[model samples]
Target: MVGFLGTYQVSLDEKGRLNVPAKFKGLMDKQYDNPNLVVAVMPDKEGRKDREYLIAFPQEEWLVNEEKLSHLSGLDGDDRNKMREIYAQASECEVKSGKILIAQHQRERAGLKKEVTLVGMSKTFEIWATDRFEI
Candidate 1:
């Protein structure tokens, strides 16, 4: 399956638009079967030292994740709430003029300032703060 496979240093503008790495763009154009991407505020399960971040995935890849989430023990109220949160917090983003406009709330949730670290994670990628990403 098509997937991302590199680490890149990127940046976000004051308007919350991020400059996706060129390599990633090429992969999307040549290998991705999806029409768009989704950027979401992933829960910081690790609870890192104040370093919040978001995650991005090609539509096809995200569908796989969504499918898994749908099957998670939704019998409990907490599980249901978590599933609702993930779906509610995700945003559909398009590459416009070489950048993706991350919604203001999404940007804030990720604690992204001017600098960002976009790390490829197979089917998806993680957006981290410059310092938090640790290169």
Candidate 2:
């Protein structure tokens, strides 16, 4: 499957809208043909300081992940909580006029300021604070 690639530096407007790069946008249009996206905060896995970021997935791709999560045994407390957290933190957004608006809570959770970096990651893309994103 064709996937997103490369890094883009973007600025968040006062209203929290991000103008997605044309290359990535084109890929999304051609590959997914969807204007909807799912965004969620990704906490630092290594417990590193100031390393939190946000991940965006096309609606179709997000649904695939949701399907996988559905197979997990809800009888297990941990599995149930994991599903709850993942579903709770994810937000659906629409790409309008080549821009997507990041929710305020999500932006705060990711520590997003004015300047941000969008990094392509195959099926998904990540948004990181420019200062915290290391090469």
Candidate 1 lDDT: 0.81
What lDDT tens digits, residue by residue, belong to model 2 across residues 44-101? Answer: 8786647878899999889898899999889999899888867777899899999999
All candidates: CA RMSD (Å): 2.1, 1.5
In order of appearance, the predictions have TM-scores of: 0.87, 0.92
Worst 10 residues of 2 by lDDT: 41-50
Question: Per-model C-alpha lDDT, please?
Answer: 0.81, 0.88
List the candidate 2 regions with Cα displacement exceeding 4 Å: 47-49
Encode model 1's per-residue lDDT on 19-79: one tens digit a residue.
Answer: 8887788788777776478988877677553666788888877888889997877789989
Give the number of the best model, judged by TM-score: 2
Clashing pairs in 1: none
Q: Which candidate is the best by lDDT?
A: 2
